[model samples]
Target: MIIGVPKEIKDNEARVGVTPAGVRALTEAGHKVLVETHAGELSGFTDDDYQNAGAEIVGDRGYVWGKSETVVKVKEPIEPEYAYFREGLVLFTYLHLAPIPDLTNKLLEAKVTGIAYETVRDRQGTLPLLTPMSEVAGRMSVQVGAAYLEKEHGGRGILLGGVPGVPPAHVTIIGGGIVGTNAAKIALGFGAKVTLVDLNLNRLRELDDLYQGRLYTLASNSYNLANATREADLVIGAVLIPGATAPKLVTRTMVSQMKKGSVIVDVAIDQGGCVETAKPTSHSNPSYVVDGVVHYCVTNMPGAVPHTSTLALTNSTFPYLMRIANLGAREALKKDPGLAEGLNTYQGKVTYRGVAESQQREWTPAADLIS
Candidate 1:
């Protein structure tokens, strides 16, 4: 199989799909890998690195897209790359299609076999591909929130870990999943008072046991969220619903009532955000004031640290890539139920139930479509 790795073109996305080590793996396994020129540069990898790893360096994304049997990417394809889509070619990437109708339609129209990383699930019901980036985003959420809390950044002008004589800041996280858990860990480490909310009592119990009262785990409810928000200096929106849009836990009215100058790090912005007012922002302008609450909604936060992100993401993604390559996507999906869950689209059909249901399209079971 011929695989193409194109330089990510999404706003603030610097992580490339393939690394030199990954290229060597694919090539050693008898697959031909073509990396577009400078694809790895932003991730601190030189073109010579890929060349030494037995990858052919291609100049244009067009050639990579046109010739490769499979095209791998970090982010969703932007508008300019829309026409490069072709039938029979496999597209493996983080296709956040629930929020992007145009991209979904384009993928369907192109008839490419789209396998989305976000939709991929393991037997334990964990997002294997999305976990590493979630860890990165989760940790960064608090870091960014603390920075935004400074007076210079139009925040509450309070330090995350206040001086011994002063009271520490309060952080409220919506959700108790990977992102929220990591955020709470960081906030607690900073000596801030923290609360994480989730509907699952068992999950909350587990968190409580793990943290041992270092932070508070509350049963996620409207009143609890509102109360927490009223006292919070930083609110991190870390909710998720797999391939679907995140539930809007914080409404515009809720934002209006939040403590003045409090900072919000909406890590769920990639899934259209759990905060009602969050519009996708870029690294250049990562935050905006919404009803006195400062919102940090950069969809590509991991991109700001490309070298680390690229390595972290590729490490999680490479094993699956190897599986799909060793046994074609069709067979791999058929044999492994976890990989089968990744089948967002096969050929021209919308196979993922959540995406099809969200968009109100005809849903085809991946089992039926892949064959």
Candidate 2:
């Protein structure tokens, strides 16, 4: 099988799909890897590194896409790359298609086999491919929020961990999953008063015991959410619904009620955000004021740290990529039920139920199509 690794073209996106080590692994398995020139440059991997790993360095993006059976990418294909899609071409990447109908339509129209990392489940029903990046984004949410909280950044001028005789900032994290959990970890590390709201009481209980009651865990409700946000100096919107759009738990009214100059880092912005006012931004323009509150909803938060992001992401995705390359998509999906869950589009049809329901479109089960 011939695989293509193209340089990411998203706004301020610097991560590459495959690293030199990943290329070497594929080459050792007798698979050919075509890496576009400078694909891994931003991630601190030189073109020579990929070449030394037995990968062919191609300067033309079209040639890279034109020659490969499977195209491995870090992010979903942007509008310009949409022209490269063709029948039977396999696209393995993070396709948050619930919010991007245009991309979904293009995949179906082109009959592309679209496998989304975010929807891929492991044996334990956990999103293995999405976990690494989620962990990165979750931890960075606090770091970014803290920077934006300074007075010069239009924040409330409050320090995350206040000095002696000054109370620490209040942080409200809306979710208890990987993203929220990691955010809470970082927030608590800063010595801030952290409150986490979630719908799962069991998970909340687990968190409560895990933090020894230092981290406040609240049962998710409109009232609790409102109260938490009202007192929060920084709000982290970490809600997720797998491949579906995140529920808007924090309403515009809630944002209006928050403290003036407070910051909101909506880590769920990739899934259309849990905060009503949240919209996808880029690292170039990461934040905006909404009702006196700041919203930092960069769609590719992990991209800012491409080195760590690429290493962490590729670690999880490489195994699955090898499976598709060696066994082919049909045979691979048939063998691993967990991998089949990653199939968002195949044979010009929506294969993931979450994306289909979110788009109000009909979907055929991957089993039916693959069988």
Query: What is the lDDT of every predicted structure here?
Result: 0.91, 0.95
**Residue-wise lDDT of candidate 2 within 252-282, one digit each (tens)?**
9999999999999999999999999999999
lDDT of 1 by residue, 1-371 (tens): 89999988888788999899999999999999999999999899999999999999999889999999889999989999998998888989999888888888988888888899988888888899999999999999999999999999999899999998999999999999889999999999999999998999999999999999787888988898888887899999999999888889988877888889999999999989998989899998888998888999999999999999999999989998999889988888888888888888777889998888778889899988666
Q: What is the C-alpha RMSD of each candidate to the true structure, in Å?
A: 1.0, 0.6
For model 2, the superposed segments whose C-alpha errors exceed 4 Å read none
The parts of candidate 1 lying over 4 Å away from their true place are: none
**TM-score, every prediction:** 0.98, 0.99
Cα TM-score of candidate 2? 0.99
